[model samples]
Target chain A: MRKFINEPSKVAQETLEGFLAIYGDQFAQVPGTLAVAKRVLDDKVAIVSGGGSGHEPVWLEYIGPGFADAVCQGDIFAAPAPQSIVRAAKAVERGRGILFVYGNYSGDRLNFDLAAEELQAEGHEVLTVRVADDVAAAPPDRANDRRGIAGGFFVSKIAGAASEAGLDLKSVQELATLAADRTRSMGVASAGGTIPGTDEPTFVLPDGKMEIGMGMHGEAGVRRADMATADETVDHMIRLIVGDRSLSPDEKACVLVNGLGATTRAELLIIARRTAWVLDQAGIRIHDLQVGDFATSQEMHGFSISVFGLTPELQKLYDAPGRTSFFSGANRH
Target chain B: MRKFINEPSKVAQETLEGFLAIYGDQFAQVPGTLAVAKRVLDDKVAIVSGGGSGHEPVWLEYIGPGFADAVCQGDIFAAPAPQSIVRAAKAVERGRGILFVYGNYSGDRLNFDLAAEELQAEGHEVLTVRVADDVAAAPPDRANDRRGIAGGFFVSKIAGAASEAGLDLKSVQELATLAADRTRSMGVASAGGTIPGTDEPTFVLPDGKMEIGMGMHGEAGVRRADMATADETVDHMIRLIVGDRSLSPDEKACVLVNGLGATTRAELLIIARRTAWVLDQAGIRIHDLQVGDFATSQEMHGFSISVFGLTPELQKLYDAPGRTSFFSGANRH
Candidate 1:
């Protein structure tokens, strides 16, 4: 493996240690648990999210003001245990209750739900909103069954904003659900990433071929097709996202062109350029555009496009200042 | 050849177009020139930095309030022409002259110096400070002959901050030069990236081997050795930087662990963890720590470490609010 890792089995723990060393002033690990919680707490609803480890800057780096209050990280491509989730919730619970926001995946749902039940038994109010935004993961009739992907970024941003706005648990939960429902994403993979400690990649594609809608962990995508140009790939992904969201002309939306690991910022911008043109052609006014690595799959080479159709309320929350190790939404002075 | 580019020849232009499309509200292209100027120019000495285009977000994304007032972009892996540099300087000049800060490359030095002459002839004061902070590129006696690597980020940042504080052109230039002198960096590459419009990789490494002190564009490094673990690599890099800068116990410094291209954030944080430990062992206090892609060679699988020993004034300026598309320094609310 060409990675700078020491031991494959300890990569996840070391990654978290490294994160804390750099950002410990703003975030800290919950004692005896693989849960990272914000160093400062507010007397409002708490927002928590997490899943696997390899996708750095996802749930971990997103834990800060106007983002998740805590994150429970699992091992590479695995879900955090229920105990860790409960520990994270307990660390941030401020008596306004706790709301769980995360990508829609079976392991994540099972663990978070179990954690919710435990928190409820302890007399703490708990709610959950699973982001189901990957259009190619399921048909329209079963949208809720779709895997979440990069659109979970939107879900977390809005949810964290609502919580920061001092909304009650139920209200924050509702807004988070709405954000998840309105968001859609699709991704194409040029190459799969290798899990640490393994010499082989998670998956492989023949030269000159690409996979559409690949999951963050290299799960099978909708199909494998011959490689296409950046514009062509973005057009296809945008079509799937727009159609799945039933977005119409004259609507407003926030767009996120996310680079899966190994993709350059230049390529993301190129993808963003094509994305804006397509949205403009459809008369969809882009209220905000964010292009970067919000979520990633190790060193996987590809990108994902996410669109969050916005109501005025959602737009306001989305525009609110957010500060995180990975995503920064501060306005220029 | 697994990239999302449309045409390799148009990659640079399209990348700029994509950047403008997303950031048009804050920046604009100088008409008929490959120069991007901040939309709102201040009355202070203008800060301009640019070079080749492949390093997305380097000089282009750095153009904004509290950063570069303008940036002149050249084609991939080439310096901007003298005319473009002059054009960019004119776009942001407010009778307070211009301060040009960028990496020390022969091509860049030639063009920027030529532009400085032209701008001077037009009755505009101009100053230049070439960043030469790569310790591995030269011996101590010939430090000024060293290549500028990721440490240019610190130079632009301090220069931009100095200018934003309403310092005079010469004062800003002095502070920028001071920043350049105090900064040190070293990089290692496991694999090289392919340039746009080309099917061949820029350089190649045999399996399980890595190159130390590699240049941004895959220029030959100091040596090739068997790949080492993250901690060992970071130790060697930190030693070279500390020795070159003569960093001492109790000295405060800012750290930047920059990913070249394809390295994952997890790996970066892992590197950061070791970086902090090593510095701490030497009794060097970390004033600020930033781990991300400040400067990158497109899709190159490696990273660099930059340490900026901070003076009190420099530390204060570095902490001042600065926001760009890629960086944010607003205090958390």
Candidate 2:
């Protein structure tokens, strides 16, 4: 493998150690657990999230003011242990209670729900909001069965903001659910990511071919076809997202053109350009546009497009200042 | 050729257009040049930098209030035209004059110097500071000939901070030079990056082999060796950097572990863990640590390490608030 890893089995632990070394001033590890929590806490609903370890800057790096209060990381492509999630929640539990906002994966849902049960038993009110926004993962009628992808970023942002604004746990959970409901995402993969210690990729694509709507961990996509130009690919993805959301003219939305592991920012920019054009043609106002590697799949070669149709309340929260190692929106509207 | 690009020749322009679409509220293009300037220019000396287009978030994305005032973009891996540089400088030039800070490359030097002369003739005081911190590119005695890599980030940050603090053009240039002098960087590439529209990579490496000290554009490095573990690779690179800089125990420095395109963040975090451990062994104080894709070679599967030795003056400046799309150090000391 071309990865800079020592022991494949210890990659996840070492990754967290590395992260703590740099961000230790603002965050700390929960004792006896692979959970990281913000150094300081306030008497507000605690927003917590996490999942597998391959996606950096997702759940861990997002732990800070105006974002997640804590995150419980798991092994590569695996779910965190229930105890770890409970510990993470307890680490940041204030009088207002705890709120969980995470992607909807079978393992993740099971573990987070179990953690919520434990926290409730311990006398802390807890609520769960699972994000399921991947349009290609299921039919519209089965949206709740779809896999959560990059659209979870919007859910996290809105939930974090609402919590930071002193919302009650139930209100925060409602806002997170609303954000998840309004968001839709689709990804195209030019290549697949390899797990550490593995010489082979999770999957393979012949040269000049690409897969549309591939999951973050190389799950089946909608289809495999010849590689298309950036404009064409983005146009197709946008169509699916817009149609899935039943978005209409005059709608205002926040757009995130996220790079899967290996895609270049330049390509993301090109994709963003087409995205803006298409949305404009449909009379959709882009309230905000972010282009970067918000969520990744190891070294996968592709990108995902996410649109979060904004309600006025969600828009206000989205515009609130958020500071994280990988993202910042302070002093801006 | 797995990139999502419609026309390889138009990638750079499209990248800029995409960037403008997202950031137009705060930045605007120069009337007749491929240059981006901040919409609001303070009376302080304007700090400007630019180079080839492949390194996204480097020159253009760095334009903001406490960062770069303007940036002139070139084609992929090519230098911006002198006229474009002049136009960009003029767009942000205030009565306090302008300062140009960029990498030390033959094409860049020729163009930026020509622009400085033109700006001088137009009665706008202009100063230049070329960053040559890539230790592997030249021997210590010929440091002036070294190529600038990720260390330019430190130079720009310091220069921008000084300029934003209302320093004169000469002072800003001097501080930039100091930052460049104290910074050093080296990279390892397991594979080469392919320029857009090109069928082949800029260079090639045999499978399981890696190049040490490789340049961003696949320039020849010091040596090729069998791929090593992340700890071993980081140790080798750190040894060279510490020895070349004559770094001593108790010295303070800021560290940047920059990912080339395609390197997974998990790998980077593992690298950072090793970096912090190694620096601790040397008794060097890490004043700050940043790990991300500050500079990148398009989809190149490798990373670079930059060490910026900090003096009290530079440390103060480094701690000052600066905001950019890819970096933000605001609301913190």
What DockQ do you compute for every candidate structure?
A: 0.61, 0.68
Using all chains and alpha carbons, the TM-scores for the candidates as numbered come to: 0.98, 0.97
Candidate 1 clashing pairs? Answer: none
Q: What's model 1's overall lDDT? A: 0.88
Model 2, residue A44: distance off in Å is 1.7
Write candidate 2's Cα lDDT for A1-333 as tens digits: 788899999998888899888887788899877789988788889888999888876666778778899998899889999999999998898879888888889999999999989889889998899989999999998888999888888888899899989888889999899889899999999989889998788779999999999898899899999999999998898999998886666568999999989899899989999999999988898888888888898888899999999888998999998877777872224
* Candidate 2 Cα misplacement greater than 4 A, ranges: A248-250, A330-333, B248-250, B330-333
The 10-residue segment with the lowest total lDDT in model 1 chain B:
B324-333
* Candidate 1 chain A, poorest ten consecutive residues by summed lDDT: A324-333
What would the per-residue lDDT of candidate 1 be over residues B1-72, giving only the tens digit for each residue? Answer: 688889888888889889888888778898877789987877899999999888877767887667899999
Residue pairs in clash, model 2: none
Instruction: In angstroms, give how far residue A167 of model 1 lies from its true place.
Output: 1.6
